[model samples]
Target: MKAGRKVWSVLMLTLIIAVIAAGCGGGNGKNTGGNAQPGNSAGTTKTSTKDNKDVVIAVNANFITLDPHNASDTNSISGARTMYEGLLGFDENMGLSPALATEYKISDDGLTYTFTLREGVKFHDGTDFNSEAVAINIARIQDEKNNLRLRKSFAKVAKVETPDAKTVVFTLTEPYNAFLNKVAMAGMISPKALEEKGENIVKEPVGTGAFKFKEWVQGDRLVVVKNEEYWQVGVPKVDSVTFRPVPENGSRIAMLKTSEADFIYPMPTEQVSEVEGVEGIKINKVDSTIVRYVTLNTTKKPYDDLKVRQAINYAINKEAYIKVVKSGLGKKLDSTMSSKTQHYSQQNGYDFDLEKAKSLLAEAGYPNGFEAEIWGENDSETIKGMQFISQQLAQVGIKVEVKSMEGGTLSDMINSAKTPEEAKIQMWYVSWSPSSGDADGATRGLFSSEMWPPAGANTAYYKNENVDKWIAEANKSIDPKVAKDIYANIQKTIWEDAPWAFMGVDQIVSGSRDYLNGVKVYPDGSINIRQAEVK
Candidate 1:
């Protein structure tokens, strides 16, 4: 066991040094120069005679589910976005805007929302989209038996009314300032399809987006065909799109280089230099709202002690993590939410201080530190991240065992525990993006006590009465200033409590062939292919 531990330690140290060296070396003088523009920017790649309408995007993971209302992971959400859209949608900057809904208004009391549906819209299955359709979709999500993943976002809805074919009214039991953002995330599905498919909607999806589901060969690829009869005339320039899950970083990059795939998300930051100046390829780097962190299971031993949690936070070097893990393509996270998140407030964060960490360990009654395990997904980047964390924590006498598991297995492991004491997790290295683009979206599902596992994403089992109260107040406050203040306080308190070893905010990076155009990646890392075209 000691020998194995030594070998693992050596490997982690070597990886950290190599990554730091790569970052220091900088982008290999090769200009990533091309007609490449931001995903949302106006431009097109060089035209090709070949059928450019058929595009393939190589993603790092398989789609968890196609049902937008139940999907949680980003990959699944991206798949849902290809063929499903909500009454509202997010722009490149993650700002809410109209999509299926032409216009909407919220009452002064914050209990009512009235929306005017777009006229003459039709679902992929040829069902007419009207106020009743919207009402049906909303009811399906709010239904308790269905067990939708985002039901909490609409739990307060008291009633749904369709006054006319074009107008829908929503009456809330109480104020919810984040309702608009939540609506933007609740992608609309065909009412008829829902009735026919029932729980099978996750596999066979039908929506009113620019694309329609074609085929899904689980673990292989999922395909979507263009909705030629789409509501938006002349849009959805692509004929078909195929999403392949290539979990290996090198393979995904190779697919981009060989034209086997037109695009690849989360282009390995370490390989940005290798792909730069490569023919028929371009890279898109944009500021992102995605934040990565190590969740310290506050209910576990050692971590149960406040001083130990704070010590772990101080032991990690955020700047070094950015340099090594992300190749300097990210910023050190100072708050729970990324700076790109709406109403985010920066707070003072723990700096790397080995002496301070040691002192805290002693105070926590662990002068020699304690042994613990760190969990993460079995992806290349996630493994590296876990190793780096293990190496960093070791510096402060904390012996960390790294366990990387498959995505689904990890989810089951984290959620299987019925109570905090039963949870086997000691720490988990993970990433989160508040795709809803609201402060409540960032806080409520993550920091709120009510969002514990089996219910929400608060896997850390972290709870604080003051923080919980603040989150509640912030979610209901219609005033922006009040919400901002409450969020600021939340950040400050959480940072001090150190429930997580806040890592860094990723700079969303994706690569594609010059022929692929009109594809935009939101700050939350979900790709928007509404206007995607292979030119």
Candidate 2:
């Protein structure tokens, strides 16, 4: 029964690109197609992704949920986007873009934000798109009882008023530079569906996007059909969009080559060479905001000790992580946030040192490494990453058992723990991108004590009095300089605290058949299919 709880309630919850010479497929992810590799590198004979009526996306993991607010992971957020619309949205570059809202203005005083609604738009369920609909959506996220992961993003909202059918205004208690980005992340749900479906809306979602949910079989495939009533005219170019989860690298690669999948994300950097000379497949690489790390649960045993946490960071070889795990396609993470992120500030230390790691482990009362379990998604790369980490940690006398699961099941395990004492994760090998594209989005949800699982994604259960104060100060600052300084302190403190084993930032690589067009992966590593069509 607990597992049946809506993900909306639970899951609210990079790199250098130095290997560009080795041909990883380039796209700075700044603009849609700029700097990308040619559609067909080989320019050989093959069936074009052209002239097809439907498109299939093969992803490395399963979607966690369809509920926009509760869609915690990028895959879930990507799936939700097919059926959802927000007052504001992020462009391919992660810049703020108007979605349901036609235009907006912020008061010079920095507390009030006013938006004009897009008219003549109807949700997939036929509900009118208006100020009230936006109000209803924000209200759900603001409610603490619902435990929405999006709550923190909207925490500053002091008031929301619909001045007219087309106008909605928000008054925040304090200034938050990231507010607009947060607003963009809140995919607007249909008021009619929310009232009717209630919690069931997680499975039966309704929205105002180019496509509508047709079927979701879970762990297999999810389908969406063109929304005839979609506000954007001449869109939904494909008759249907199917998302298949093929976790195995070999199988996913085979699917794309055999025409079973038109596109596959995480194109398995190790296999990029296999598809490069292929006839119908194209490889796309981009500098991204994604960071990979092993979350060391501070509330759990062997990790509660600060020295233990630091040792884990010291033990992992960040260089090998890029060279071996990422196939020399990424940069070693230099800070809590990717260097590509706004307000990013670098912190020193955490370089690979086996002797130092062993010493730290001994100092932490673990002269003979203690046994622990590490968790990750059941995908070839992730399992490989985990194995790599396990082997590296082994050198420091830390023996770990690796565990992997589907995205949905992983989300459930992390969120089911209502409190830190009930949490089970000792270490989690995971990757994160602040989909909202802000420093607060990167820091708060993962490091703030207030965000501990079920409320937000602070799965490490890390907390600090000074760090918390700095986070609040940073959020409330109106000047960029002041916010920048505060964020610097937050990063410096977190880096020393070592709640995570800083790994590497990704050089995002994805592949699609030469015939596929318009589907793109944003800098935040989110899949965008709004304009997906055959070549």
Candidate 3:
């Protein structure tokens, strides 16, 4: 019998900135710990002093790395809160807004991008913003040793040239329609700083952001002081920003409840209502691109069979999983592409049916059900979610052994599971978010055959000639609509194959005291610290 297909795919087909001061010469500062009163509409924090008192911004995880060219994790991106600047930033409405580049123009050929630097911008270490700085920063990212995180996205750039002191031009080997959006990454560091710090600089960042880096004690806290000399006058109202790494969900919420911290970004969903009931605490919820999904090792056993893959997809009850695991903070996913994204197709991917799954299992010669290993990050929610799936799969005779480990370790296990001999785990839970709006932003790193196990991020070992062909054609297509349609097809095709059992999209929650102001959250989960203020 031909299976009823969802519109989504399931087949076996394939596919900134300037300088100001010279050194770390600033005033003495004190850390005032407690609940901060809300700031006025101007986005300021009342408890913060205009002078030397530092405002702290706490996080659950420490940064993975600070190199804009090399870092890929959210922690590293979030670390940009105080350390880097990009040419464009997301505004309160989640639209693109200017940052370092005052104005930019694309050549008639659409093969070159020219950016005119805004005057008076300076690096935290006091280097002037000019053509030389721009030239060097681009070159550093192009350098192979740096292993910049998003390097493949820039493979089309022919060269970076500075025509004048304030003007920089990026000549592309081929016209890249997504180039502008790709440059929205906050990891763009200053060339001067890179030359000075070499490989050691990420630990000590210097950028033209609202806050200035002061000190980072690994696994504990990263502190930043106010940038009084910041170009945008009256901006970054807070005296300073600090990121404290407290991994436990309960403790992180407790820190906010006890007034130990002024603001807690992304409060655990399970603890949301409890925190909201507390007076003086506000829970701001918004839709986001952060998604948690299960990636099957397509090249490995059990999963290699399309029916088995489909069986796995049909066996689990996603609605129940979301209700319990997400704790009311998720939206079901219909495709690998985020629902919040513009190009997403509304077609459904999979709907739960245990009987059909069992029949598919019997057809695949697993009538008795087979045993498989599943992996997820050690986080409380992730482990619990996987355990739930284990129980659901058991109803169909598939025994799932759940393994929990740190994210880095889990990543290693998935990466190493490429070859049949080396395959240890058959399935794993993974989450992803696009660095920017472009389709290339999500697919280039995760789907490309270029990224093999251990070396690149292709964890599923998923590859298809058709997907690759579509990607290549889309890359060459200059027309935005044409490219979008092709990528949309790619999303549909990927969904049909079931390489990943689409899971859920998460909501990014920010819990701030009434006093802290200027906190705007992006669907991508990035915070615009520059636009925030402390009263």
- lDDT tens per residue, model 2, 1-535: 4444333222211122233322223222221111122233333437554556788888888888898998779899899988898888888878888889999999998999999999999988887989998889999999989978788789999999999999999999989888988989898888999989999899988999999999998878889999998887889788899888777766666666666778889887877875676777788998999999999999888899999998889887788679767888899999999998889999889887666788888898998889999999977789878877877787678898989997778888988999999999999999999999999989998888888888887888999989989989898888999999999999999999999999999999999988888999998889988898785
Clashes of each: 0, 4, 31
Candidate 3 residue-pair clash tally: 31
Better of 1 and 2 by lDDT: 2
- What lDDT, from 0 to 1, does candidate 1 have? 0.83
Worst 10 residues of 2 by lDDT: 27-36
Q: Quote each prediction's TM-score.
A: 0.91, 0.90, 0.86
lDDT of the structure predicted as candidate 3: 0.69
Winning model by TM-score: 1
In candidate 2, stretches whose alpha carbon ends up further than 4 angstroms from where it belongs are 1-50
State how far residue 149 of model 3 sits from its true place (Å). 1.5
Please give the lDDT score at residue 413 for candidate 2.
Answer: 95
What lDDT is reached at residue 46 by model 2? 77
- The models' CA-based lDDT, in order, is 0.83, 0.84, 0.69
TM-score of predicted structure 1: 0.91
Clashes of 1: 0
Of 1 and 3, the candidate ranking higher by lDDT: 1
